[model samples]
Target: MGAVMGTALGAVRVVGGRLGLPVDDLAVLKDGSNLLVHLRPAAVVARVGAVTASVRGDVFGHFARADELSRFLAGRGVPVVAPVAAPVREGGWVVALAEHVPHQAERTLDSTTFAALLRELHQELAHFTGDLPARGPLDDIDAVLALLSRPADLVAERDAVAAGWPELPVQALHGDAHPHNVLFTAGGPVWNDFEDAWRGPVGWDVACAADSRLLDRAAVQRAYPAELLDHWIGVRRLLVRCWVAATDRYRAAPPSPSPSP
Candidate 1:
């Protein structure tokens, strides 16, 4: 196993054991930007920011905010994956324990249903009054550019994109509203991963969910102007590229001191 994955697994096992949850059957459910571990024989899943820790300045704070938002959504009858407990700082990793709902990872919802569900989520999110970064993912660009030593071409593109950022009505958003973040459970499609939650233009969320084959672009355009959607879509694309570059550079660098919790 890779060092990051091994460390994440060990941390979850330690945290799970401390909480009196079973660890004998602990298994990794997913390992991507972050690690999702199922603390089995129990319904708890641990979200370990293995890779995210490298880029985010406050990994614990990030997960804590997500946990808070999930609870809020759950209390309001939103179909969101709520946390089982608060985020725990252990072994230099931030671990969030949440209810592990069984889901069909390969299931795909039709465009109409998908768009409608996303709209429902947005409706609820509008009521959230929590503190969130105003610019959303756009706020991460400077830090990521710094990590990549300010690539000339990317810096120019970022500047151009920043100049076009719209001034529109803002609300809490599922910052990363892609189809993959939706879990198709028997109960229904439950949204997961609020780590990127932010207060920004609703268009930002719309653009995030506008996967060509998964959501009808016309449906999205009806709610927000097509021009605005197109702008946010371009911005989202740029942010994605910046994050990819940052993750690569962060991973390639030598280990650094873990941030204080």
Candidate 2:
């Protein structure tokens, strides 16, 4: 197993012990930068990751934030995956738990349904009235630049493009508003994964859904400012490029050595 997956399993083992659940019964569901595992004989799901930006680095802030947001949304009757147990943070790893929703991953979602859910989400988020990180895609430009081994010309070009965007009305938005982030269930669409949640232009979310090409762009334009939409579209393209580059670097990195017995 890779280091991350091993760490995830170890964290799950710790959490499972505390909950009196069998670690052997746990099954891996999804594995990536984050690990999703199903806690069998229980309705909870464990999301293991090192997403925190903290002093001790014992907690994953993004996952922590998601748990908080889930509770907030659930209180207001917004459909979302619910958290069942307190998160476990130990040994420089975090195992956050949440209630799992049964659903199928549809190849495509109805444009009208998707837009309606987004509108509902926007409405609820507007009243969140809580502190959150401001969403500016370029806010991570410095990190992206470093990750891609910054070229002077590319840095200048990216900065220039970023400078041209005019600020628009800002509110708490689902930072990564792509279709995959949304879960369609028998009840309705449940918005999960609030790790990227931030205060940003509403247009950013609209632009994101549109970029997926699964929504009616014309309908989105009618609901949001065209200028903001265009600006975010440009920003999304840059974000995707940086993501691709970073993933390539990560995949090319040397694997950790196994411990000697």
Candidate 3:
């Protein structure tokens, strides 16, 4: 698929001459999910390329919807990926671009640096929730319903807890906040994957971050804000457990929502 798209793009470049932008293939990185590429004009102004590409991402939302998020994050002063030139208009398939955030690797999420970044992210998220459509854990429940196991009571639980919790914030959110989704740069940590930005509780996102076994638990607890940590761990057993049932790693047995004969 990568080769096919590259070839077609090359063909277009040949026909359009200078107008046909050359797409530079950025070879596979540590994570094998994206097909990295660079887009540039015919003019020679070497060093920095204006835009970078990641073919697809699980967190990406519809273009217009995503635009709202990208802009919102910028307004809130969060370090999320910056949207590049408007998405190239293509029917059926879509390609989105963002300014390449150059950064060093910090795979370990337990460092004080990481903890500080998380604090910043939560702060920004708190601000982010004030501007968008307010949603609750209930929204996530619907999507993962078919994929979960022993999730029969999840819906009821989400409703009650959400009622007890404060209203969902409307500000721009990373939607899927996870360690890997965050990248470090000279400016600080930048969150990637804006597809899931929506008006939902930090409840689920924070839970996923703190509960990730891949991360150093002590470091997270030591560093995260008291309120943030409280909410994250607060819903871990119920929401996060339900999320696990929805994930591919689990053999989901989401109760059949069927009518009895």
Candidate 4:
């Protein structure tokens, strides 16, 4: 839970037990259902990071992939810790109960910090491989454009990017790199939520994710070099503006009159 919905310790214990949480010592985070149980006996907390039955859910196959990636990172001695085990949920949904890190890498990130994490996540994305669900930019671009009330140039830009994107160096990207998905801990920035990860160019995450935030594009441009940052900023604005217009279309569209039978 959080400041919004304060959680109860007793309620936590019950959920913990249901998930075979240790009946002994650790403290529950109360928030981040990802770490659902605290193993008092072992001084560890188990994060309910994945649900097998969540095929149509947010973190469906993510449980398995999260574990694999976590392990992969740890083996490389990257600042992240591998949650205890990346096991599949026992029944129905493939729920995963992984180790909960004492602290995440980053939170409430400024431009510098967020950018650094973006670079780190990009590195992790480069290492990922194996059979995983996929979603293409063509589909995403079309869906986003169809719902928007923007100029056709917006859709045309997306189309152009899609066609030319294949020529770029593709890596596994953290499909959605918005603020909430990144965690701040003592280490640095721990990226989470692999639900939308896909083999794509850094621009998919870099150009796309950066623009989604309310960061000042001009300031970012000033901070980074001229040429490199300029291209990214342009792409970022295009992506974020289109998304904004898309979300706005339905909200701003006029309501239709009721049919008179």
Which candidate wins on lDDT? 1
> Per-residue lDDT tens digits of candidate 4, residues 1-261?
342122233333444567666754646554333435566765445444311111123344556666666666667655544565454433222334455655533346776556566776666657767654444344445556654443588867876655544455567766666666666777665655554566655655655445645454443333332334345445556655654554454334422211212
Local accuracy of candidate 3 as per-residue lDDT tens digits, 186-242: 876777765555565554555556667657656655665344556656555565555
Point out where model 1 deviates above 4 Å. Answer: 222-227, 250-261
For all predicted structures, in order, the TM-scores are 0.92, 0.84, 0.56, 0.54
Model 2, 164-245: lDDT tens per residue?
8666778888878888888878876788888767787887888888777677777666654345677788788787776555
Deviation (Å) of 216 in candidate 4: 4.0
Q: Candidate 4: where are CA atoms >4 Å away?
A: 1-20, 23-60, 102-107, 132-167, 212-214, 217-261
Report the lDDT of model 4 for residue 238. Answer: 62
Residue-pair clash count for candidate 4: 26
Point out the higher-scoring one by lDDT: 1 or 3: 1
Please give the RMSD to the true structure for each candidate, in Å: 2.0, 4.0, 9.2, 9.1
Return the TM-score for candidate 3, rounded to 2 decimals: 0.56
lDDT of 1 by residue, 108-210 (tens): 6765577677788988988999888877676777768877789999999899988877777788989898788899999989999999999988778778877
lDDT of each: 0.81, 0.70, 0.49, 0.51
TM-score, cand. 2 vs. native = 0.84
**Measured by TM-score, how close is model 4 to the native structure?**
0.54
The alpha-carbon deviation from the true structure for residue 39 of candidate 2, after best TM-score superposition, in angstroms, is 2.0
Number of colliding residue pairs in each model: 0, 0, 12, 26
Segments in model 3 whose C-alpha atoms lie over 4 Å from true places: 1-20, 24-66, 75-77, 105-112, 125-133, 136-141, 144-172, 225-261
